[model samples]
Target: MNLVLTVLEITAPVFLLAAVGFTWVKLGFEYRVEFVTRLAMTLSVPCLIFVALMRTDIEPSALTTLTLAAITAYGVLTVLCFALVKLAKLDIRTFLAPLIMGNTGNLGLPVALFAFGDQGLGYAVVVFAIMGIYSFTFGIWIVSGGGSPTKAIKEPLVGATLLGALFLWQGWETPTFLTNAIELIGQMAIPMMLITLGVAVARLSPANLGRAVWLSVLRVGLCVAAATVVGLWFALPSVALAVLIVQVSTPVAVTSYLIAEKYGADSQDVAGLVVVSTLLSIVTIPLTLAFLV
Candidate 1:
């Protein structure tokens, strides 16, 4: 009973913010997704990642372990998703990336923050960074049929991750005033991302709802299994382990639908995955948290 309330406390703000965006869009209000996304990715999100990584009090060794574990977990998920797509006779290009990469940023970070506080946010950032790098590089290549690794390197998120990791390693701190400014900007990222998610979903028109439902179920099951195996293999600490499970098991990201639309890989199908998986998270996240907490 107590755990149920705890999970509610953690997830309510996230969905509520997203609901605001959804309702705003349904009511025929204007919200420019491209501009908001660009702002978050280029500025706010990078700031958030940098600040979280820079100020994290977790041991360096623990961070490294979690990083390797996250990489391995994603690697396993990619292979598994590919096999599933092939066997299911699905369009590999359309289904593969979304299945492999979860919504670790917009959804995962905030959940981690609310559920486990700052340290969980710190651990969540590491997983999100790894996933972001993979999504920009390999995920793009899969969607577009070809992409450059340099594109990932050019992303501000990647740069922020590298810089933040360096700062963490060296035990360095930015000047107080500068740190405060950066933190303020970083603080905007969570709500903006959540709201953007709702806006994006509101605008999307998902197709093949029946198929999407089952596929989304498969994605959740496979991701949770892979993350659990990898976390146990790495002997991750309790908090890091919980973060791993939650982040990896998050719903399909709305970005996947955007990528599919841009690359002409059946955007409607991808949109279905995003909508179904995200809706599924309202139930799955709470249940998973009930166990983890």
Candidate 2:
């Protein structure tokens, strides 16, 4: 019962609300869904990241570990997914993005907050930093299929991160006006994200369910295994290891679908992958955490 409530508290409410929103879209609230997701991706999310990074108190040692961990996890996953494409003779473009990009920011952040409180959130911040940049850079490149690696190397969020870190380093508190503005915008991030998730869910079809589920299980399972080994090898604090395990185990990111749609890849498959992995994650997350935590 306690575990059930805990899951509800951490994950289910947003998802339930998402279902409601999904129903609304099914009934023709399509514009609202687009508005919410765009608001999140363009405004609220960046504000949230700026505020979180600004307020987080990071340690140098932890930052180092986070960089190493992020690189190892993502790098290994990329190579493995590429190999899987070759070995399985699957559509490389269709599977690679969803397989390699887990929902590290949205789901990962909440799990960290639940598991380790402020310290866990702190660890999540560092992990978010590394993964966020990599996602924008390497992620865009891999999914874009532009045939030029340079296109993926630009770092838009790097400026935001550096500015936030500069303030953190200076120990400067955000002035009332700036903080208030950020708070206002950041407050919308979750609702917008959930609404987007709802709309994305609404768009999923049965066509790709089988392959998507199989790929999702393979991607998430391998991600957890690799993260666990790396965490153990690096001797991360148990709580930090627990956090990494959950983060890496998260479903194919919602953004994976968006990116696929953008790149004219297999958007249906990516969307299906997102739905399958997210549904399965409720069980996988706690199971992995129970053992690792």
Name the best candidate (by lDDT): 1
Deviation (Å) of 80 in candidate 2: 2.1
Q: Which residue pairs clash in candidate 2?
A: none
In model 2, the worst 10-residue window by lDDT is 149-158
All models: lDDT?
A: 0.93, 0.70
Against the true structure, candidate 1 reaches a TM-score of 0.99
Residue lDDT tens for model 1, 1-36: 777789899989999999999999999999999999
| Clashing residue pair totals per candidate (backbone < 3 A) | 0, 0
TM-score of each: 0.99, 0.85
Q: Candidate 2 — which residues are off by over 4 angstroms?
A: 1-8, 32-34, 147-156
lDDT of 2 by residue, 3-88 (tens): 65665565565456567767877897644556666566567766766676667766546656766886787778788888887888
* RMSD (Å) of each candidate, 1 decimal: 0.7, 2.8
